[model samples]
Target: MTASPPPADDLSPPPSCPDAAAPAPAQALQRLKVAPAEQPLSAAQKKFNRLLARVNSLERQLEQLQQSADALRAPHLQRMDALRQRMAQAQRAMAQLLHARLQRPGLTAAQQRAVRALLRDLVHAVPPSPQPEPEWAALRAAYPRPVPAAPSPEALQQLLDVLSAASGETLELSDLEDAGSPEALIEALAERLHAQDEARRAAAAERRARRKTTARQAEAQAQAQDARSALRGIYRQLASSLHPDREPDPAERERKHALMSQANTAHERGDLLALLRLQLAAEQVDEAAMARLGDARLQSLCLLLQRQVGTLDRELAEAEARLAHELGVQVRAADPRRLLEADLQALQDELQNLAEGMEHDVHALQDDDKALKAWLREQARLAREHERAAREMTGFGFQF
Candidate 1:
């Protein structure tokens, strides 16, 4: 009997890879292939890919959130989150558009409205620009309770008016809550308002984060400018003094010229660390020439930095010495600056207390051991004396 392979219709579609945005069409049609179906893919595979794109889009949004310093607004966090959910729903709608995967045909109509609502919220959160005077006046007037909130009719109407204010657009409202009904304009408008609120919050957070970043960058740039200005002065002074033109010997002058060139290059390149090394190497340069180039300002800056460095170094050395003495062990210098009083002070204090406790314990143990030794010796002496007395009493055979 010839056994036939089981029909391909019995096989289920393979699980889609999450990372794959587009899978091979050949693999997708295997289940339906039993019927001589010529289509390369089935509806399931398309649906999965659309879902992946939606999720990937959401992740990009989260990444944007992380790169920002300002998070959700306090007054509208919950509202914003709800707005985000709507946006996710909107993304689902987008996936449906790609895959044509909606289970219910009527659901598509409602989903589309929801998508618009989400967009409305996003728009409110991050408007293209500030509102016109009349629009702002309307918005401010509509949300009357000294604050704005959901179900604020004035606010809602005002928002509608703002949207309408754009050239030649008519926005209508129906009073029902069912998004499925095109006639239910109020539900659609309310949904849009919620989305707008979320969008507004997201925009506000983004603006705050942008301001903070700009401020920080500005501060760093200012400090860098100050440092470069100071370093350039030092380099110029050193260069003028060491220039080969001042050298008496031609051979020596050429070497000095090379060093001066290196110094100038180092200064231009903002290589402070290299400049320090060059300063050490420039010891052979003429002393009189070097001194003539010195500036009071440059000297002042150097002295200030040196004084601070010296202070910190001395403090660190004292800390290291104390730590070494307490440990009763040679602790190698782990740092060039040694230990400052502020660095690890809490841990050092705890270590000091622990070391003191250990010493006390050692003294107690020594005292206890000495007392035990003395007691043992006394007991032995008494035992020997008793043995001697008994021997004297029993010595009648050798009586002398």
Candidate 2:
């Protein structure tokens, strides 16, 4: 038989030689690749995927919101700063004019009263000085009472009462007395409110931490072991496969090093979705494997995804709230940019009108005594009306 020589096409091995009939390594690998369309996702898997998508969507929205807010804030702050400077300069000029008028001689009682009222407004509008002004003593002697009698004892008491009611705490008049002036008192009140808010947030955080600890304890008594096992299994598989030190090829090892770093981070964070994504990226797992996860593991992963969604939701809300506060407008989900622009334009117009009005008042007071008197009379009438309204509202003269 050997001497006859077999035909060149006759390449079949003997039936007893099973090893000779084995497939090539490349062909064996091809057998392991399952078509994704073959597996239909279960309800739990679908829910997990949906939650993961929601988290991604929320994160993208937050990032875009931050970028948009920054873009709007830059120019808005610049323009507001310019307008504020102009207003400050005008206020200073008016203050100077009022002070000069108060020093002039031969003034009637009514004129003196008018000048005092205007000067009182200027004093209250300006920040208090560390040292008293030179004219302060002279004016106090001439007036026989505080000119700018703002934040009086009754006013301070009312403020304390309001704050106490709001905060559900008792506040006495002495609490704000250390501030020394109306402006300082107002600042002190603001500081107190901020401190109260911070305390409330801290308390809330502590409560949440306690609740989390209790939840973790409960989980330990139930399916915590299974959840931990699932997480560790995925991490271990990734670590073994992506072990850069085990790889000989330099380029492949470098690529794997980066992947290994990400895997380590996801493991430490207990981020199931991120680990799943990394596994998919490494071709270690496919959609079929993801869909076929154990019921307990799938449940844990779905819960994690839900929590991630909630956290992202809260973050997005806080970012939007901050933007709304900075813009001084209520930001709706639809067309927030347009709303901010409209509000900003209105603010600009108001500022322009205020500047014009201040300029007109300065000119009128400087040029004509009759104009000043007439303005003073109008102010008096307005004050009487305001006082009457206050009496009607509160049945007391509680200066707001």
Candidate 3:
């Protein structure tokens, strides 16, 4: 016996061909006399198609929900990410101004320490360092003679090798070989180590990137395979019920031939729902017959339906979660566009406030710097006068 037609729901107009042109209705009915009577669908087949339709409908609904959620989430995610970047920039700029203010000369050690402590507190509260240029410079200047870490064994050995090579006064490989002092040798070794470390890091990152790409490709292939499997199952069911070669009546054969062509096209395109609907249209299954199906077949149909429902449920849940994360709220079935607009407005307001604050802090720091310079100049003038007076008193030979 031929396999039964696949379950149906995805409906589309079958493309027309020359063979699709129908004869007169009277002539077609007469042609049916010589053909075998059309068989009524069994109770099992009808029930299976009905359950399949329900499953397909649920799947379609879930797909639409996911698409809608993604559509709503994409812009909001991009906007939020952009706002985060801008906020970080503003915070970093403010930190730089604070750091620069603390850098002015002539403050007492305690006063300098207090200012630095305040800066640290503020930075710790909302740290944002795009490049850390200002912060690193301040650190370096504060500890110009910071205790140096001892050279590694490899570095020491490399230094020794360099010294041995340079021991022959006439031999010189490069300017680096001429490094005679301990500091010079250490610097050369440090440079070499740094370059090697950078190279290793680059190689490691490249390998990780390759692995990620391979994983993504494998995931895509798996999804494609699953789609093909689903379409194949649906196609098999459709072919069993609608094979034109099985229809002996010329008129019925012509009609089945057209439907079979449509089925083939839908299967090729991986349109499972279309195949299901086509089978339903051909009267391969119906509602009343579904109610009379055997227990075994009904149970099998139930299992397929349950599987479809589970798949759709998982997909829907993932889409909902993604949307909620993007919006920073537990969104349900509400209109997402409106909610995202509200979030966008709040973010814009925050961005504006941060920009104004950054600008004000920058101006204040510049003014403070000018005042600091003036104070230092006045102190210098006072010292010069005191020195002149001391010289004059000494020259006058006044003994007190």
Off by over 4 Å in 3: 1-61, 105-235, 240-275, 281-283, 322-400
Q: What is the lDDT of every predicted structure here?
A: 0.43, 0.65, 0.57
Clashing pairs in 1: 120-196, 121-195, 121-196, 125-199, 125-200, 174-185, 316-339
Model 2, range 257-353, lDDT digits (tens) per residue? Answer: 8888988987886666666655655556543454445545666666666767777777777876887788766654335566667877787778877
For all predicted structures, in order, the TM-scores are 0.19, 0.57, 0.40
Candidates sorted by TM-score, descending order?
Answer: 2, 3, 1
Task: For residues 285-315, write the lDDT of model 3, one tens digit per residue.
Answer: 3333334444454444444455556766666
Candidate 2, residue 212: how far the Cα is off, in Å: 18
Clashes of 3: 11
Residue 214 of candidate 1: its Cα lDDT? 77
RMSD of each: 42.7, 12.8, 20.4
Off by over 4 Å in 1: 1-219, 284-400
Give candidate 3's root-mean-square deviation (CA, Å).
20.4
User: Model 2: clashing residue pairs?
Assistant: none
